[model samples]
Target: MRHARDFAVTVLVLGLLGVVAGVLWSLLAPRPPYVMTGEGPFLADPSTQALIADDGWFAVVTGAIGLACGAVGYSLSRRGRPLAVVLGLAAGGLLASYLATLVGGAVNLAPASITASGKAVSVFPGPLALTAHGVMYAWPTLAVGLFFALEGIAGYRDSPLRTPFGGQDPYGPLSSYDISDR
Candidate 1:
């Protein structure tokens, strides 16, 4: 029961962090600098064009999320968790971030302008849409990668070495090696 409760807390914290990340991305994302000033229902306005042109920014935001995930994964690994637990946390964090992006999209308000003849009216409205591209998957992938990298680098000793007979330090390998020889 304790393990389950801990897991739930971890997931909850990760999700909240994901929402924060999403909000930050929405606030920081680049948007169209110009507004439409023509008549006849200009659907493909300059703002829309700018959005299309800046598709790379989405990936950038995802990469930032990935780095955050990696950091969290690394921290978890350092806690002596089993590999599966670490991986699970990474997956949870990614899912949370994805959900967060959707929330962010819904809450995002951007400046929009509609023009008729020589007059223009500007309004701040929710964003057109938020999308999750395949590139966004890199966030979780990178998290797993970083977790392993950190685990290897830190050389955390979660348990004593065991042999097929389940005896710790069965071979005395560490005793055989001289630290000065390295």
Candidate 2:
């Protein structure tokens, strides 16, 4: 019961934090307007290529959700280090997420547009964007979001219920309710 409660509260808090972080991050660099002619400053090069590709609102929302998940996991598993769990694996996780996004973003099968060309360029049907986005951006971001949320959960571990099997939650016996009854 306690662990369950912890998980729920932790998840909620982490979810909020992730949403906030994601929103703020997006605000810092909101999607620039799509220029009709050439590329802008955010794009990769001056070759009329739009700088930051529009990932859509879905990315922002889903990214926040994923971050919340990671935060929840971190909250459940951390040791003495409060911020350590989230902050600890953050860099590595971010890198993994980015790499995954790159791989997923690959449009090898169905060719994409280079610039303002509305013509369809089809090669294969192996779109990797969503795949890469999931690993590269989703998981790590959620992990960081969970870190913030778990901080609150950690504070509520006041009673520190001890189980017969020396486990946090009881799969066999000595859960929060049973232990109290005993």
Candidate 3:
């Protein structure tokens, strides 16, 4: 029952964090500048770097959030089953990434193109969007990776083979050198 509760709480908290990630991505993601003309909107500068940067920002923010979630999840589930915790992290990370994309895109909705008067060019900010959809995987991937890494570290720390003096041997206390002499 306790494990179930922990899982539920983990999922819920991560879902909420996803919303926050979305807001953060919206704020941090760069807005590409577009020139609005009668024909359509075009990049103000020849470079599309800003558009790529926006995606990078989204990945960074969400990936950071995922790492936090992994650490937090591991800490919280120390007394519970790790498998349950990992599953929760995976599910939550996926949900969070999707939410971040949706909310960020919605929050940064592009304005309708304004008709430029005569030779005047109207500059507008483009909508926040993920040019590389694969970037979304960063969240879940980092989350799981972090969780496993921390788990391995903790396991290593508590391992019996990690003797303080390195004097103990796992094979019936007989060091390999001693056995070879016999």
Candidate 4:
């Protein structure tokens, strides 16, 4: 029951953090410049760097948020079941990633303008978009990876194989060694 509660809380917190990540991505990601002509919008520059940069920004922001979520979830679930906590992290990460994309895209809607007799009229920045859709997985991947890495470290520290001598303790008793042996 406690584990279930903790899992629910973790998921909820991560989902909320996704909204923040979306806002941050929208604010930080750069939009490609486009010329609004009579025909349609066209890229001002031939280079696709701006489009790629937008995806990069989204990945960076979401990845960072995911890492934070993993750390927080691990800390909160110390007394809970690892499996349940991991599932929560995975499910929450997916929700957060999806929400981030939706919120960021909504926040970055194309600007409205009336182009009369438009012939290479005004130059407006395009909306934020992910050129590489795979970037969306950044959140969940990082979240789960971080959680496992932390769990492994903690497990290793508490394992009986580890000893104060920096090696395996075959004797099974620390007191068995004479104090003068040091």
* lDDT by residue (tens digit), candidate 4, 15-50: 898889988999999878787667898997878698
Cα TM-score of candidate 3: 0.79
Error of 1 at 108 (Å): 2.9
Q: Please, what are the lDDT tens digits per residue for candidate 1 over residues 1-182? A: 54465456656666776677667666766544443435523434544654653345555665666667667656754544545546556666677658656755666555667775777665344352444356446556666677677776666444334224466556587879888998
**TM-scores of all candidate predictions against the true structure:** 0.61, 0.36, 0.79, 0.79
Which of 1 and 3 is the better model by lDDT? 3
Q: What is the lDDT of residue 94 in candidate 2?
A: 53
In model 3, where do residues sit more than 4 Å from their true spots? Answer: 109-118, 163-166, 169-182
Candidate 1 structure, TM-score to reference: 0.61
lDDT of 3 at 91: 85
Candidate 1: regions farther than 4 A off:
1-6, 32-42, 46-49, 52-55, 110-117, 121-132, 155-182
CA lDDT, every model vs. true structure: 0.59, 0.44, 0.82, 0.83
Best-to-worst ranking by TM-score: 3, 4, 1, 2
lDDT of 3 at 131: 83
Q: Please give the distance, in angstroms, between residue 131's alpha carbon in candidate 3 and its true position after superposition.
A: 1.3
How many backbone clashes can be found in candidate 3? 0
Worst 10 residues of 4 by lDDT: 112-121
lDDT of 2 at 96: 42
Count clashes in each candidate, considering only residues at least 3 apart in sequence or on different chains.
Answer: 0, 19, 0, 0
Model 3 lDDT on a 0 to 1 scale: 0.82
